[model samples]
Target chain A: MEPIIKVENFTFYYPDSQVPALAGINLTVQAGEFLGLTGPTGAGKTTLALALNGIIPNFQGGRMGGRVMVAGLDTAKTPCARLAGVIGSVFQDPEAQLVAEVVEDELAFGLENLAVPREEMRQRIGAALEMVGIASLRHRSLRELSGGQKQKVAIAAAVALRPRVLVLDEPTSELDPRGTLEIVALLQRLNRDYGITILLIEQKISVLAPRVPRLVCLNKGRIVADASPRQILAQEKLTTELGLEVPPVTALFRMLRRAGVYHGDLPLEVDEGQRELGRLLGSRASRA
Target chain B: MPGKSFLHKLNPLTKVVWSLAVITLAFVYQEPLPILSLWASVLAVALIGKVLREILPAIRGLIIFAAIFFLFQVFLIDEGQVVFTLVPGTGIGRITDVGLKACTMLALRMLAMTSTIPVLLATTPPKDMIVAFVEKLKVPYVYALMLVTSLRFIPTLQEELSLVIQAQRAWAYDLEGRNIIKRFLALIPLALPLLLMSVQRARTMAISMETRAFGAGPRTSLHTSTFQLLDIGVISSCLLLTAVLAVVSLR
Candidate 1:
């Protein structure tokens, strides 16, 4: 399977910043895989996501050193408009992306820009709205929505363009707990059911710990570790030193393993933790 | 329905076309009657659509401005019967017929222009206008997209500014002792916050537009607003009437 995006030594800097935000990073994301990008604040995760979408070289104008290939085209060579078809980016702030009063107009915006025909856009916009589970809000204005609903509408607009991969930069940072779960659940559905590739930058470990198959940890613009989500969670000392949160379930499992109460494969999610406990208690009950 | 207004039924394009015609007439014709009638027609349309309430503020601004102009012309310019003499001719006070004509032109033209705001703005949704601009004139879809986005945010920024002003007022305990300038000075902090927030929003909006597939090239729009038969007929008839009015005024 061909990798959808290949990043080699990507780095970026804002206009007045003394030091580069990111430096010398290499990574590749294959098709149909959920890739988790996690790091402490200022770890260059968001900057890396921006680089993936061609915002860095084209819009920001930093001294870029490496190549980023998305859907077989070099991001450096490709203009923002063309790269947009293959990589859909959702900014952390949904308020920034909403351009129209009505939800239908917002969804149609991306498609209109793509110059998709009117008939097809109607169908695609309808489908995308349904995918994010906000079809009922097709006529609601941006001002009337909660933050989470706004973000979902933003995501629906991104997905409506039919991009091969979706990139979100701390998408749930503005949402409440319930909103966060709703957005995460939608993303999971897109990955699992639609087979669209996903790249998300988040600081919350509970957000990425159980969902993504692969994780890349960054610190001070460098990739310190890249491995399976379970393996990355096991590196508690390193993660804590970097000021990142370890998910509650992952931490619980880590303690249980140390105490010899859990010996089988470590579970990353809450349901798995409950099942493991039930199995252990069941065995004990039988023995007694 | 018997109460349905004509302005509500008029196409947005027709409203714009007629408004432009009357605005153009303001510059050419020296007489006030045409403009007066134009004002009446606009008001009648607003009344029909129940959009009369929407145009009250603009009408208020125009009336105040016209009064100022009439007063200035009557007092300053020396024309017709000298209605009053105050400290005589450093040309301080005089009301001439020519001066009256000038005042009429200024006042009536101001009224003529504002008189149509309800017709163009209140009768149609701003989003549909933008969509029409794209679908009909083939103005690039991006321009229409931008127009709608900015329109969407107008109320948000207005509400934000309102809150800022209220917050500033709450901090001050005194109610009525300050002079007007002092009251105005208090607004500086509020205005600065609005300016700062708007700049931030602009930068973010620019980035957001790009990420959503707004390309530099020509593209079709997803919005679909069609011209009704009434739209076409209304616009054409307005154009013809304007042409006739121009010819008659010239003769």
Candidate 2:
């Protein structure tokens, strides 16, 4: 099967900046895959996200090399508006992204821009709100919403366009832990049930490692690591060198293995770690 | 939220028209009677709308500004017969009857005419103001959205600016204890970072707008702004009264 997104030797430099924001980067995302992207600040995560939807070379003018293709269309050639149907981008700051006053109006904004028929727009808005679990907030003012609700509304606004892929750039950076969980869970649901390809840039390793099967790590505008979350977290030296925190569960497992107490592969999630620990102790007790 | 007073029931555009009527009528005649009467009518609307309390704060500031303007006109202009000379010898000594009359007319017109703004603001939310711009003023929907977004960012930018100022103060930058020029000069450090942040915000918002297909096709709003019968009545009466008053003043 063809990948939903493909970036080949992609290198980009901002205007008047010496260092390239993204340098010789190669990446691929399959349809319906949940890919987590993480790196320190100014690590080119946002630049890469913008490139996926053609905002880089199209909307934001910069020196660029190589190509990025989304949904069979080259991002360099396609205008950001045309790519809107193929890629829905949820930005970091929910407040900055919201242009409407009311929740329902925010949802309708994208569909209206896409010129969907009035009847169709209403259905899509309803479906998007229901899917985001914010149907009751449809008529409420955006000002009165909690941070999580506002982010949900932002997600609804993007999803209303029914894009093929969703790109979120640090969506939960401004949200609380519970709000972060709601968004992560929402992304999981979108990936699992709707089969929408999700590219999430998140810093919360514990939250991201458990959910996203694949994690891509960027460093200094380069894709230094691309593997399963388990594999990525197991490389203690690489993760530390790149300034990424391994999930606490994964770190504990690694420490146990290093101390010669446990002999098993590193688990990226808490439940998996718990199971591993239980089995290790049970076997040890049996031998004793 | 505005109370369900008769004025509140009128569309925001009707209120805007009423404001324009007051401003125009205030400038149309040199006499203070018409302007004061117009100002009283606006006050009555504010009172009935239960927004008098909200509007008073803005009116208070306007009164101070008007007072300073009145003083300038009465002392500086020297357009009519001399009335009083408190200072006796210098260029700023004389006060004239015509200057006093002009100052009173100008200040009262300014005070009364400008007071309508506070009334409108007290009665209309920013969202309704954008709605009025979109539906009544025929501004493009995207531009209307920009207006709303800008209004939303004002408080956010203010907060961010304060943080920036505080951060600078922590670095031992003397932002206080300065003359007017020096204080403004001290703000340069604040302004640079603020401008950069504002630009960043604008850029992010623009990118977000594009990703969501902001201008991809014909747009439709969830809440359609339609004028009520009350809006129509208010608008017509306001225009008729203004026109009649204009003709009378001209005569």
Q: For every model shown, what is its TM-score relative to the native structure?
A: 0.85, 0.93
Please state the CAPRI-style docking class of candidate 2: medium
- Predicted complexes: DockQ each: 0.58, 0.61
Model 1, span A69-161: residue lDDT tens: 899988878888888888888888777778887889888877877778889989998999988889999988778899999999988988888
Q: Candidate 2, residues A57-141: lDDT per residue as tens digits?
A: 9888899999999999999998788899889999888887887778877887777777777788888999998888889998898
lDDT of 2 by residue, B1-251 (tens): 64567777667888888899888898898787777787888888889888898788898999999999988778777687888898777666688888888889999998988899888876776777776788768988767777777878887799899999899999999988559899889989999999998898888888888898777766665555678988888889989989999999989
- RMSD, each candidate, Å? 4.1, 2.4
Point out the worst 10-residue segment of candidate 1 chain B by lDDT: B1-10
Number of the predicted model whose TM-score against the real structure is largest: 2
TM-score of chain B of each: 0.81, 0.90
Which ranges in model 2 have alpha carbons more than 4 Å from their true place?
B79-81, B88-92, B141-143, B248-251
List of clashing residue pairs for candidate 1: B5-B48, B79-B96, B80-B96
* Model 2 alpha-carbon miss at residue A79, Å: 1.7
